[model samples]
Target: MDDSGLVSFFRVESCGLYRIRQKADGEFISDGFPEISKSLFDWLSDRSVLNTIPWDPKEHTRRDKVYCKDVHFDSYTGDYLFVLWFANSEAAGEVGEVGEVGGIDLNSKVGDTNNDSEKIDAKNSTGKELTIGKAMYYWFIPSLKLVASINFKHSKTDIEAFTTYIKKWFDNKNKHPNKT
Candidate 1:
């Protein structure tokens, strides 16, 4: 958590799209795609109403479609951790083409709640949106207010090896605290 009592919050969509946010002066730091942002806002609005109304299967299905995975936080490092999975690039052909990267159609126009179509322009992205053929592991540090680290794994074995290394490092840190 930061000095303002604001902790970094993250949300990851099923297609590996993600956004990080922190409440500061009534504004949010968001990097989600336009379609994703609309979907998330709609889901949140519906969720609030669902609490007052009876359970509905359609709403449950809608909720599932919006969020398919969980984002975890590493307490030791104060890092918000998550993984982004991508399709095999060799099978997909190229990276820049729509649906060839992270399954997101970059060229598609996303509409707002008022039904106005809004294109996802370059200004909305941070240049790291097109992650292809790799599983990306991210660590966002709240104190730094930025993504401190990102590791890309090309195979299951690579992911496992990195996971083991992270666990070992955390264990070692636990065993030996720095003496000031």
Candidate 2:
């Protein structure tokens, strides 16, 4: 193999999203550092929490009627490693809108619990200071939740840690199908 060894960190949070941090030192792109706590709203966008919408604005044009943001973010393992750097782009546009729209906000109430959440390591590696490759982020449908993400080996990304995480939003959508 032209490259040495490849590593990946999977941080799955309650926000319904999973983070896959890819690491390959020499062939890496972004710096290797754990993604700590990004803001709620921004995190959603950065995490591509809107692309999961199964409905198309041009057709249903729904997902446009909410103001979302995580109140808390925590992985099963809780790997609160130091954040190196992170950057994300959109294949369509923002998180929500019409065929041309972009952005995702469903009025969340996750609150400030994320700060106190446990900070677990990347399980295998220290996830301290390393190099990251490509940063991949995706979202779910209907609830417009975060599903899965993958970072490729590049020159700017930090893939030292893969802390699996899920988004726990406090929105109507988050409510069970059969509410009291």
Candidate 3:
């Protein structure tokens, strides 16, 4: 699929900044525009940015209302990067409304090592029935060269999952460049 088609399938709300630079001799030069920067990359990678959607001057910050939707291509690295942004809070909870999103409570009985569907379902505020044991296929998006796919559920996605996705992307890019 092309870029537009991937965005449509993922139901992306906004596109994040992308930077493509090349090293000539020793100095790095921007490919074309200068909108994307290392700082923007750092900001996008930061979890705090995911929870900090702008709001009215008086309202309290609401992390529950926002979450990431999908992975986007990193032009320079040729790997898909997780980009988080705002979406309808209710829609965020519905299955298939968005892509590759899930929720979890770190303090819950579910340990970090296991994605216990029963524990996660029981802990989820949405109280939706668990679609456990279903094979999630989006883990690798070949069209976008994405090594990791996301599972969208009604729970807040865990930070470990995001980190794992990044690591997988790097490993795949290095070990199987064409596959990613």
Q: Candidate 1, which segments miss by more than 4 Å at Cα?
A: 1-70, 88-133, 152-180
Across residues 102-141, which tens digit of lDDT does each residue of candidate 2 receive?
1222221223222111222234343332222122232222
Q: TM-score of every model?
A: 0.25, 0.18, 0.29
Best prediction by TM-score: 3
Q: Write the per-residue lDDT of candidate 1 for residues 51-160, one digit (tens) a residue.
A: 21122336543321111112354557655553333323352444334443333222222221321112233445534223234333445454544442353222211344
What is the per-residue lDDT of model 3 for residues 1-180, given as tens digits with 9 covering 90 to 100? 322112113322222222334653323332111122222233334333223222321363442232233334456553344433223334334533334234432222212233232323332454542222221213323344233434343323334444443333334322322222
Span of 10 residues, lowest total lDDT, candidate 1:
61-70
Candidate 1, pairs of clashing residues: none
For all candidates in order, the CA lDDT equals: 0.32, 0.27, 0.32
RMSD of 1: 20.6
Clash count list over all predictions = 0, 58, 9
Candidate 3 pairs with clashing backbones:
100-150, 102-155, 102-156, 102-157, 103-155, 103-156, 138-149, 139-149, 145-180
